[model samples]
Target chain A: MLEFTFSVILENLLLATRWTILLSLIAFVLGGVVGLIVLFARVSHSRALRTLTIGYIELFQGTPLLMQLFLFFFGVALLGVEVSPWVAASLALTFWTSAFLAEIWRGCVEAIPKGQWEASESLAMTYTEQMRHVILPQALRIAVAPTVGFSVQVIKGTALASVIGFVELTKAGTMLNNATFRPFLVYTLVALIYFALCFPLSWYSKRLEGRLNVAR
Target chain B: MLYQMNFGDLLPYWQVLARGLLFTVVLTLVSTVAGIFVGTAGAWARTFGPKWAGTCVSIYVELIRNTPFIVQLFFIFFGLPAIGVKMGEAEAAFLAMTINLGAYSTEIIRAGIQAVPYGHLEAGSSLAMSRWEIFRHIVLKQAFMKVYPALSSQIVIVMLGSAVVSQISAEDLTYAANYIQSRNFRAFEVYLVVTGIYLALAIALRALLRGIARAVFPKG
Candidate 1:
């Protein structure tokens, strides 16, 4: 039986932590871009566009992120396209994160009162101009705390990419556990590393939420 | 090259898919009920118990909240056996789901409990009710009604989360998909079908929860 040492495992785990952060960043940025488009579509004057956006959000949000990852990874292969696990994982995470971030942002946009839109219109601002100049700036304040909070979800979600054979933090932990025969110790370190990555965002989110509430 | 899709190849496995769907529903229902109770109790403790007790509950909630459910399942299923507690895949999955749901619901329920009007508790006290009686009659019921929407949404999220138990080989919908994919080699079609089913199930579950809310709290 192979025995595990805390020092050896901890060092490896910390090194693997970089991949987790990298994945989270890729997922967040790509998801943010997609979410912006969805948010715009949702708020657009066209009913068809709005309904289509709603469908996209519901489909992504209503399903588990894990299943989504599987579908992307395995489903793409069935289409005779050779895609890497990294590409598949990123695509799935981007879609999942976009759905959630779009919803969060939609709420923020709508929270800006009708009067603001009306005032901007009265000033003869076009829809795009109003959105860019008048409305989004206000909505961005409401969006900040929740956006930061959602990043924690995004970070934790990177773990699911492991199941698809993406070698991130959780996958590394699993590999090390099998090699060292130390499931508990390896997973505890895995959990703690995730905590280290996530807890600060959670704290900052809470702080921002408090500040936002005070401003309101 | 786009492969010609044949969902018909998956037709024979409908029975497996049905059984998996049933298990998913049953697992979700049991866990959501159990989770609500656990969450309510945890919220109560956090709100009314000693400082240390509240702090401990806070820690528990934070730990579960920040970690992935897949990791939690593996820890329970694989790690617990080393300590001599052996549970079947389904049981361990349910236990983990309960713990995971409890942590999330605790935060939601705490917000609901705190939102209860102070006047209601005072009114109960003036009626000479005991503390538990006041809590049960006034605080709990009102808090539940206020948080019903958020709580129901959380339940849907939990139900969707149940799909992850397939990782530990629990015979849920995703497991059925895996089986059908392996058998037919129609991985894409099987998943597409399963995704549609999950979407329908989620909508149906939300409608069911809304119906229950109407029946339970008409005023709400």
Candidate 2:
């Protein structure tokens, strides 16, 4: 058995952080786009669309993300398409992130008073126009803190993508542990690296939350 | 050859699946009860304990809250053995989830504690109540009442996260799904079915927790 050197484990672990960062960025950005569409559909006038969007949100949020990743990996393969673990992981994380983001955004939207909706309606603004002009701007302010808060969740979630074999930080830790036979050192370092990535975001969210409350 | 779906092959394995579900529920329940005790204590330390105790509690909560639950489980299951501390998979899973939920509930319970009015504590003091009596009789119930809904949600999230322990071969619900899929060569169907089960489990767990919350803290 190879005795593990601190530098070697640290070096490999640092190198893998790039995958974690990139995966989080891709999932968050794409999920935000999808989440925005889901948010609009959820708050739409059409009863069917609202209910369908709610179901979509609940379906993703109510289950383990690991299961979703498994489904996408095998579901794509079943459709006769070549599916990479990277693609499967991304798709799973994206949907999971989108569902959460939609719910968070909806909470913010609901914080807006009914008067704003009627004001826009009285001005003959379309539903799209009202959201774009009157409601979203105000909701966006309330949305900022929770949106940032949810990003921490999304980032930590990338860890699960490792299970689908996307080779991010968590996977890197496992590989290092296997190679070095230093489970304690390697896993401790992995948890620390994640803590380093996550703590600042959590702090920022807390700070934003405080500021948002003060302004209100 | 085309891909075929067969959930039928899994039907006979219902006993195995039942075992997995039992383990998951048992783990969730054990951790939840112990974890809440830890959280309530941690919250007390933060509120009324000495300065050092509060600092230590802060560090514990932040560290656990920041890291993913899977890593926490892996460290307990895989890492501790390196230190000559042996633990079975179930033991490790229980410890990990207890720590994870403990940190979260510390925050929730602390919020509940803070929301207790200063006047009430003073009123208790004027009535010659001991700190313990005041905490147990006055603060605890009110805190539970205020934060019970939030606590209910956290319990469900923890139950859902219990799925990850299956990675360490703890034979949780997800592990059963993996096992059935591998044996039957029906991965998608198995996962889909398991996903539905987990979703239902989350809903059921939330409802159960909410019911408990209502029973524990009567309307004031």
Candidate 3:
């Protein structure tokens, strides 16, 4: 039987940490872009657009990320096009993140008092102008905390991308565990790396939430 | 190249899909019920128990909340066996899900408990109500009413999150789809079917929860 050594595992685990962070960044940025568009559609006055956006959100949020990964991974291949796992993982996370981000943002927009919208309209502002000059500023303040908070979810969610063969932290841990035959030690390190990545965000989110509450 | 989409290849796999859907529903119901009790208890401990108890609850909530469900599943399924507590994949998956949902539901229920106003408790006390009576009649009732929407949403999320258990080969909806895809090589069609079923399940679960809420808390 092969004995386990923490030092070797720690080194590889640390190296894998970078991929996790990178994946999270890509997911967050892309999700944010898609989420912004979804948010616009969700809150638009056009009933069809609003309904369509709601359907999109429900489809993404209602299913598991694991399923989404499988769909993207194999779905693309079934189309007679081979896509890299990185592309598939990114696409999957982007959609997942957008659904959540859109919801969070819609809540923030709705949190702005109705008076603000009316006030902007009274000033003869176009819909876009009203949103840009009036509603968005206030909504942005309300959104900051929750958006930051939701990022923690997105980061944790990136771990699921590993299921489709994306070589990130959890997958690295799995490989190390297979080689080391040290499930407990390997996973503990994995959990700790995750904790190190996630705790600061959690704490920061709480702090931002507290500040927002006080400001409100 | 415009590849032909052959959804017809999946026609024979209806039984597999049906079985997967059934497993998904069963897993969701089991975990949701288990989660509610665990969440309520944790909320109670944080609200009415000692300082250490609250701290412990907070730790549990934060740890579970921040980590991916996949890792938790692996920990329960693979990690526990190493410690000599061997369990089948389904049991481990259920245990993991219960723990994960319990932590989240704890926060939601705790918020509900806090939302119960102080005046109600004082009124119950002045009316010669015992602590248990006050909790049961006033605190618990009001909390449930206040947190109905949140609790309902959490249940839906838990139901969806149950798909993660397919990783451990739990034979849930995703697992079934995976099996069918491997057999038929119609990956996209299998997933499309799985997605539709999941969307329907989510809607049904939400509607069911809403009906229950109306029955339990009419004014809410």
Candidate 4:
């Protein structure tokens, strides 16, 4: 067996970390765009649209993300389209993240008193205009801290993309472990990298939450 | 060949799926109970125990919270044996789930404990209740009332997360699905059915928890 140096292992792991970061960015941006649409439907005036969005959110939220990832990986292929692991993982995480972000933003939107909505209505504003001028701007402020906090979840979530054979941080750890047989050192480094990525966002979220509460 | 969805192929594997469903439910239950026990203790330590203990608990919570559950499960199952500690796949999954949920519930329960009014503690003290007695009757009871909904939601989340244990060869619901797919080459159908079962399970678990809460805290 060939000898493996510690620095060699670290170097390989760091290279894979780039994919993890990139995948997270892709999922977050796409999920945010989709989540905004889900939010509109979730809080819309039409009862049918509201009900449809609720079911959509519940389906994603109530199931394990691993299952969702698996479904996308295989389900997409079953459609007679050639599916890459990268494409499947991105699609699955986008849906999953959007479900959560929509729910979180809904709470912020609902937190705005009914009076605000009524005031906008009395001003002869259309529904879109009311939301545009009155509700979302206010909700956006409260949404910021929690949205930032949930991004930590989004980052941690990218780790699951590895299950579909995406070559990200966690997958890289397993690959290195197979080569080096240093499960302890390898997994520890993997956890440390995740911690480094996540702790700052969590800390910032909490600080933002505290400041928001004080302002209220 | 164009893929045609064929869920009928899974009918013969009903027993396998049933066993997997049972295993997943059992795992969720065992971990939830054990996890809450650990959480209650950790919460107490964080709230009223020594400074060193509180600091240790804080570190533990942050460490567990920041990482993915899959990584935590992988570390326990694959990493610990490197140091002479060993366990069966099921046991490792159980331990990982318990520890993961414990860290979360500790934070949740501590917030509940903090929400109790200072006056309630004084009232219990005037009644000649010991500290432990006050905690059990006055503080914890009220705290539970305040945080029960949040705690219930966390339990459901953990139960859903239990799906990943299949990766380690523990025969949970997802494991059965994987096994059937490997045997019959019906990955799509098998996963679809298993995913449905999971959705039903999530709904049922939430309802069951809510029912228990109603019975235990009728006024709340």
Comparing 2 and 4 on TM-score, the stronger one: 4
Candidate 4 chain A worst ten-residue window by lDDT:
A1-10
Worst 10 residues of 3 chain B by lDDT: B211-220
Candidates 2 and 3 compared: the better one by DockQ is 2
- Model 3 clash pairs are none
Sort order, DockQ high to low: 2, 4, 3, 1
Candidates sorted by lDDT, best first: 4, 2, 1, 3
Against the true structure, what is each candidate's TM-score?
0.97, 0.98, 0.96, 0.98
Worst 10 residues of 2 chain A by lDDT: A1-10
* CAPRI accuracy category, model 4: medium
Rank ordering of all candidates by TM-score, starting from the highest: 4, 2, 1, 3
Per-residue lDDT of candidate 2, residues B99-161 (tens digit): 999999999999999999999999999999999999998898889889988888898889989
lDDT of 3 by residue, B77-105 (tens): 87777888899988987798899889999
| lDDT of the candidates, in the order given | 0.90, 0.92, 0.88, 0.93
Worst 10 residues of 2 chain B by lDDT: B211-220
lDDT of 4 by residue, A1-216 (tens): 656798888888889989988989998999999999999999999999999999999999999898999999999998789899899999999999999999999999999999999989999999888888899999999999999999888888889888889999999999999999999889998998999999999999999999999999
Looking at model 4, residue A99 earns an lDDT score of 98
Candidate 1, position B39, lDDT = 95
Q: Per-residue lDDT of A42-138 in model 2, one digit per residue for the tens?
A: 9999999999999999999899988999999999999899999889989999999999999999998998999999989999999999999998999
